[model samples]
Target chain A: GAGVSQSPRYKVAKRGQDVALRCDPISGHVSLFWYQQALGQGPEFLTYFQNEAQLDKSGLPSDRFFAERPEGSVSTLKIQRTQQEDSAVYLCASSRDGYRGEQYFGPGTRLTVT
Target chain B: AQSVTQLDSQVPVFEEAPVELRCNYSSSVSVYLFWYVQYPNQGLQLLLKYLSGSTLVKGINGFEAEFNKSQTSFHLRKPSVHISDTAEYFCAVILDDKIIFGKGTRLHILP
Candidate 1:
């Protein structure tokens, strides 16, 4: 079976531009997660979705970030205004049993803000 | 809130030699511990996890981790590592519905 996948593996955006990263979770996966990995650091939680209903979003840094999983399978993380500090790899993960199941990760989308 | 701490930022060991990456967490209640490995230009892969019962947990690629409740630590170890073992390792713990990760330890396999 295919693992989780993210689109736009690499993206470069101007400081004020907006960007959207996509994620495709494995089929039938009910839980999805988004994380931000800064250079040389561990991944930080961003947001999570359980079948289209976002359960936890306290990890979101600020109002500039927004996410949606309308159909419960595909998700998108949108950054309103890019900043140099926003440069990092955005990872997406999915699991079958919500929080208890082991998560499967995607290659991630590396966003570089210039 | 729960937090994880990885004592070492980087560790270098010769190929086929033993290696250990230290991790400690702060939590008042029982927790689930996990070790994940990230290869260059790749996503994270789960090496192993410790839910309960056993203090010693074995994982893929011959990697293992021990859960020490008294020490509040879960350190990863490999008796003999291959060059492929060189990567970033993260120790994580489940907090409510989310996970908290440590800064990560870079394992450098020296030839």
Candidate 2:
């Protein structure tokens, strides 16, 4: 693809349900990032992956929020026991390198937790 | 910890008029500043970035931003904006290897 791609542009999940969002970064991008954007708020960092290694997960709000990049090219963000607060636009971005590189973002998946 | 503040939630500007979007950041260590623009139903695109050297940085679409270290601000500006320029602009800061964004400012360019 020419740019980063995110799957399930919209997701509606009932409380306690589990949902998974996928992200396909640009070819050979070394850094992948996930962010959660609440309504009327800026996107907040959730986690980052350097290749297949998740180097940062400090921004995950709770234990239920999990992300993985098994092959380093495609990634998934899974939320277990979804809460209302988890309802937001989940954005995925990729960069050429880890240090000070420009990040290219995906269209994002709008998750609605009821 | 680092935080970015975009004072105005929205700004309305007439076409061909100059526009400025203010942004301020707080960080304990050296930081990198960036401006991103998001069109409707689209992902964010980098407008410009302030890394080092000159305080004033020019970007695509005739947009430019100045990094003022003394005031902890990196304000974006365009001499004349077009109707197509209407979009949500976000200011972000890099601190502790993490990028944090502000609430964002919706720029409405009127024809």
lDDT of 2 by residue, A63-109 (tens): 99999999889999999999998999999999998747899999999
Encode model 1's per-residue lDDT on B1-111: one tens digit a residue. Answer: 578999899999999999999999998678888998999878898899988888999999999999999899999999999999989999999866568999999999999
lDDT of 1: 0.93
The CAPRI category of model 1 is medium
Q: Score the docking of each candidate (DockQ).
A: 0.74, 0.83
Model 1: which residue pairs collide? none
Q: Give the root-mean-square deviation of each candidate in angstroms.
A: 1.0, 0.9
**Docking category for candidate 2?**
high
Error of 2 at B103 (Å): 0.5
Q: Least lDDT summed over 10 consecutive residues: which range in candidate 2 chain A?
A: A94-103
Reference-based lDDT, residue A22, model 2:
99
Residue A34 lDDT (model 1) = 97
